[model samples]
Target: MPKVFGFAGYSGVGKTTLIEQLIPRLIHSGVRVSVIKHAHHDFDIDRPGKDSYRHREAGAHEVLITANRRWVLMHELNGEPEPSLEAQIQRLSPCDLVIVEGFKRSDIPKIEIWREANGKPMLYPEDKNIVAVACDVEIDCDGLPWLPLNNPDRIAQFILNTFVHD
Candidate 1:
């Protein structure tokens, strides 16, 4: 398996935005990046009337949809316990890096995104797995490195420097 790294933050802290901008930079550097984002509530990639949706609604446990450009596989948990992060990662095709957006409590190394406007409590203070902090305004990062949240190139470079050492 490729190395797994993550971004941990509260909702609305720009974790998604950061990752979206950072992915291309990593790819531009010739690194293939895969992302696994954890959602807190029920989410669906298929619409209600789609064939994939119909198959899943018809009690199919798995549905595979393919197009000329891409393919997707949807698996129904069917009341089973949610799989661990590692299990989900294992299902992804091989890549140079895995940028996880949630699974905050997992022990995988992560960069904590923070913003003063969010008013949410800081997570890195308690999360030993957090390797760095990316914040909007100046703050005392103490021992941890503080990355520029607005500058994705620098953030991408930092990620490459710290975690992409293959």
Candidate 2:
């Protein structure tokens, strides 16, 4: 099983930006990483009336669209409850690490991105699962390691060092 860590924070707190930057660094560091992003609202990757969407809409439990270089899979479960985080991780192919962008309430380890401009409370100040914080403005970060929010390479390295070993 791969180690799972989440980049968690409120909206506009740079979670996506940090993950976008960290992923390539992790890849350069020779770590195979898979990402799972949790979306609150409904989303459609295959547009309406598209072949793939039509296939799925017509009761295909799993529809996979393959291109020369990549593939997209949409699995639909009707009345089957959402799988657990562990189960979801298992469905993905093996990787050195798994970086989840949301699912903040799960018990998995996480790095919280906090931007002062967002005016959100510190996730770690309460959530014990938050291992560290990446922040914009420096404050007394208590005992947790606080990294500058701008440098994704450093944060990426920290994540690999703390969670994954090569």
Candidate 3:
């Protein structure tokens, strides 16, 4: 199975920024990485008036937009049901790592990004899945590994060393 890690935190806590930084580092280390981001809103990947959007509105279950070097398969579900993280991972095919940006309540392990200025709570002290914290605060981590908040490369290396290597 491909290795999995999550970047989770309260809204506006810089979780996305941290993930953005980590991706390049992981790639440079020769790990093929995929990401599954959870959203709380009704998101749309196909824009209106576009051919892909029209095809989906015409009852297409899946639409593939292909180019010379890229392809995107957009699947339309009939209802709003959250797929299991494992199921999502399966959809990504073979990869060295899958870094998820949500599913905080799920069983998957995570790196909690906490910004002290954001006034958000620490996910580590309560969630056992939170294996490490990337934070700007100096609060006691209760012995959990703490990576500097602004250093994405270091956090990525830490993840590779701890989880991906051995």
User: Which candidate tops lDDT?
Assistant: 1
Deviation of model 1 at 82, angstroms: 0.8
Q: Which portions of model 3 miss their true places by more than 4 Å?
A: none
Best first by lDDT, ranked: 1, 2, 3
Q: Write the per-residue lDDT of candidate 3 for residues 66-105, one digit (tens) a residue.
A: 9999999988888957678888888897998898998898
Instruction: Tell me how far the alpha carbon of residue 6 in candidate 1 is from the true structure, in angstroms, after superposition.
Output: 0.7
List model 1 lDDT by residue over 98-154, tens digit each. Answer: 999999999899999999999999998899999899999867877998998999989
Estimated TM-score for each candidate: 0.97, 0.95, 0.95
Model 3 has an lDDT value of: 0.86
Superposed Cα deviation of residue 108, candidate 1 (Å): 0.5
TM-score-superior candidate, 1 or 2: 1
RMSD of each: 0.9, 1.3, 1.2
Clashes of 3: 0
lDDT of each: 0.92, 0.86, 0.86
Residue range with the least summed lDDT across 10 consecutive positions in model 2? 136-145
How far does residue 7 in candidate 1 sit from its true spot (Å)?
Answer: 0.6
With candidate 1 superimposed using the best TM-score fit, by how many Å does residue 22's alpha carbon deviate from the native?
0.4
